[model samples]
Target chain A: MAEPILQVRGLSTYFFADEGVVRAVDGASFDLYPGRTLGIVGESGCGKSVTARSILRIVERPGRIVGGEILLRRHSGQVVDLVTLPSDGSAMRQIRGGEIGLVFQEPMSSLSAFHTVGVQLIEAIRLHSPLSKKAARARAIELLALVGIPRPAHRIDAYSFELSGGLRQRVMVALALAAEPHVLIADEPTTALDVTTQAQILELIARLQRERDLAVILITHDMGVIAEMADDVVVMYLGREVEKGPVDAIFHAPRHPYTQSLLRSIPSVLAEPRARLATISGSIPHPLARPAGCPFHPRCPDAMPGRCDADVPVEVSFADNHVTACHLYTEPVA
Target chain B: MTTPVLEVPVLEVRGLRKHFPIRQGLLGRVTGQIRAVDDVSFSIAHGETLSLVGESGCGKTTTSRCILRAIAPTSGKILFRDEHGDAIDVAGLDRKGLRPLRRRMQMIFQDPFSSLNPRMTIAEIIGEPLLVQGMRDTRERETRVADLLRLVRLPAAYLNRFPHAFSGGQRQRIGIARALALNPSLIVADEPVSALDVSVQAQIVNLMLDLQDQLGLTYLFVAHDLSVVKHVSHRVAVMYAGRIVETAPTKQLFTSPKHPYTEALLSAVPVPDPRRRAHRIVLEGDVADPSNPPPGCHFHPRCKYATEQCRTEVPALTEIEPGHAVSCLRAAELSLRGVASGS
Candidate 1:
């Protein structure tokens, strides 16, 4: 493995609430190398989005990163700890959009409804670069073209409401690239689009990631998207990493019970016509009232009686790059 | 798989059209009609799931609303036969006459939060249909509401809670329970599981399928999720520019799609396998505005194999197989070249 561009070690984020402190992200860790895409897959309330927000220090009020080390590789070849960096400091602000660009789930909501797509892109460019208004506008147009938006010269001036969902998302990608960031964090960018549009967007993202050598942290519930784009996969459940490995390894042989259950639950077109879909019976446990031992023990079909319900499982190694937190693959099993 | 338990089609729509008058200027005069849903026709068999799928603004929702009579259709024939086997014209029903028709068909809205009244408790929300239909006695209503909640997998104790207390999936379940309160035979679910997580989506789709099996209900399932629609639907209807481009059995539609639009849609779905790489038919260009749709085939502007004939003459839907129908000038000549080439 190459040297990682970003390293998240023992990351834990919590929300201070009236009822109790909610451990929204608990001891999650991953590494992102340059020019590679790492996908974080989970259900809605599994803290995947929260984990992404914590990386940028955009975890809103009531939510705070309790413990962790976020190491980022600087352009000068220096590794800086993002956690220890002062909040709202100049260096951190420079990294927020300048070094690490974020593309939110809904382009319509993230982009200003009132402003034209070009105006927003220009604004982002001006924030990161010392370009004049005209230069920034040209840069914005260039970024739009870079993201595969055809006829950017004409479509750039259109308002958000006027553009299609796919076009708007392309503009969001353009804005993300306006500052020439090394890393892009896309949170369910194609979830709001149709299948045809989604495929186009995914292909665009993959092509751009290669051309720019940009490291990407993609957060999505769609496994298909993860499979198509991600080189490495991280399965998050109830704010913790259940499995992390190469996408091929994880898909071919998921060691964790939670990961297996999730994969089985998905209805695949490749599967037999009459094959019954497997469903993990039970909603994701609320963050406030999470399970004691294994967060997935309550729903695990192959859970050990005392082992899965009595203690937390450590990360057991399957291969050089594969790791899983499941009692089924503990030291005793080996 | 066992033989399909085929039943007579309970609802048939012919040449359905819905046009919203576009108001212009300070005088508020109607300038032109926004042709949201134009000349779309399909039939729903008893206990069968018919999915209407297309991108946003393709008139799938408008078609559903027209069938529900929530918004009156501009012109069409909505022939529905009730449980008594009596044919009724749903489009001609007024507010007073529509009351009885409402008991025969119900609508499950997309957004659970907005569709449900915030002020009403779960019980009140679910029981509203019963109350509106003049179901007397508070005791009987409470029991029926409890049953509905249990049917939707919600605990009976949650009857007193409000919509804000439930998660998106739970809220959608509540919406389903409310739609089923009146024992309607036909349920028009407009993207019921679109807002849910992928994992939650399968659970809801399975639940709907199970409910259909138990109750023998017909569903007009409208959604953009091809995977979910292909899973839950018995027959699939592919819509483009407010018109159905193709209608076929679920398997046939996925494997042997006739229309270029249908072929493009199926090819776009990424197979969830890291080892296998599937070809994606990238549709370039935006969806045309329905108000001023293309002269002939609405999809010609973006179609890869579009010819001069497709640009001049509008193709009429014709049966290519026993039950499969497609609206394409070159249905006989076109071939889907990818994974969905043949059955």
Candidate 2:
């Protein structure tokens, strides 16, 4: 395997609210190799998005990274720990878009409504590189065209609101690629898109990854997407990663009960018509009231009586890089 | 479970059209019309689920809204069968005439978060329909609410709790309980589980199927997720640019679709199995704008097998097989690939 472009270890992000500290992303560890896509799959409130934000050091106020190490291999062949750098400092700012780009779920919310798509693109371009306005505008048009936006010259002048959902997302991709970053973090990029549109966007991302040899972190709640795009998979329940392995291993021989149940629960196109989908027992617990021991113990069908409810499970490794955090594979501690 | 009688449809719609006139200039003159629902027609038998599947702005929701008379259609007949087995023209009904019929048809909204009122208790939310129907006694309403809650598998003990206390899946169940309060024969669920998580969505889908079996209800399920649609629907109508391009039994639609758009849609859905990563037919352009669609077939602009005739002449939806319909000029010649069998 090639060298990993980014390595995240023991990442824990928490939101300090009046009620309690909400562990949005707790001890999520993963490695992102160049030219390979790592999919972070989980349901809503599972903290996949928070993990991505933590990596970029852009987690909003009242929410901060309590513990983590985001190690990024820079273009100069020097590895730097992103966590130690001040989030607003020049070094972190340079790494944000210059080294790693981000595409958010809601394009309309992420984009500036007042500015034209070209204006935003141009600003992003100039911020990373010392370019004149005309040069930046030209690069912006090129970026839009690269992302498969039709008639980039004309569409560039349109406001974000004027564009359709699919086109708006294309512009967002264009903006993400404005700085020509080596890594792309797409947070539920196609969740808001139609199926056909989603196919187009996914294809675009795949093509761009191949072209740039970019390491990609694709976060989504859809297992189908993870199966389709990811080279490796990380399944999170609540805030913690319950399983991580090669995509095929995770899908074909899932270890964690949460991952297995999630795969079985989603209705598949291949499944027989009207077949009853196997469902997980309960909904995700509230962030403040997260269950002790294993986060998925409450919903796990294979949960052991007192073991799964009393003590946290340790990571158990298997062949083919498959790792699962479940009491089923671990010995009971004295 | 009793088999749905195919002879008498619970609700039938014919040539439904909903056009929102685009006004422009100082005088607010009618310049153009967005044909949100254009000449759409389908029928749902008792205890059957017929899903309207499409992208956003494809008019699936508009069709459902028109069927419920929540929004008036510009033209066409919404024939809803009454308890007497008489097909009532809901489109032609006046306010007084529609009041009683409203109890026979109810709508479930997409977003559970906003569909429910935060101020109202679960009991009040579910019993609102009973109260409106002149169930004067609070005790009677309470009992009925408890029964409805049990039907959706929620505990009757949580009746006093507000919507804020429940999770999204629980809230959706509450919404379903409210929709079933009137004991409507037809339920128009507009993207009901699309807002829910995968695990929770399956639970709701199963609940809906179970409820359908138990109550002998007909569902006009509107959703964009083909997987969920396939799970719950007996038949499906594929919509594009305010029109149904194809309609078929769920199994047939998945195994052997006749329409190019349907084939593309089926192929585009990402299969959960990594081993089945087949080539997806990427549609070239965006969905056609309803206000100014193409000259003939709305999907022709992006279709891979589009011919000259497809671009020039409008193709009427024609039945290719029994219960399978397609609206393409070369429907006979085109052997479109559906999702591979054994998915």
Best candidate according to lDDT: 2
True contacts kept of 2: 0.76
TM-score of chain A of each: 0.96, 0.97
DockQ, prediction 1: 0.47
lDDT of 2 at A94: 94
**Ten-residue segment with the worst summed lDDT in candidate 2 chain A?**
A325-334
Backbone clash tally (model 1): 0
lDDT for each candidate structure: 0.86, 0.91
List, for all models, the DockQ compared with the true complex: 0.47, 0.72
Candidate 1 stretches with Cα past 4 Å from truth are A271-275, A332-334, B1-8, B118-121, B153-165, B337-343
TM-scores for the candidates:
0.95, 0.98
Q: For this target, which candidate reaches the highest TM-score against the unseen true structure?
A: 2
Error of 1 at B163 (Å): 4.3
For candidate 2, write residues B131-174 as lDDT tens digits.
99999899999989999999999988999999999998999999
Question: Which parts of model 2 are misplaced by more than 4 Å?
Answer: A331-334, B1-3
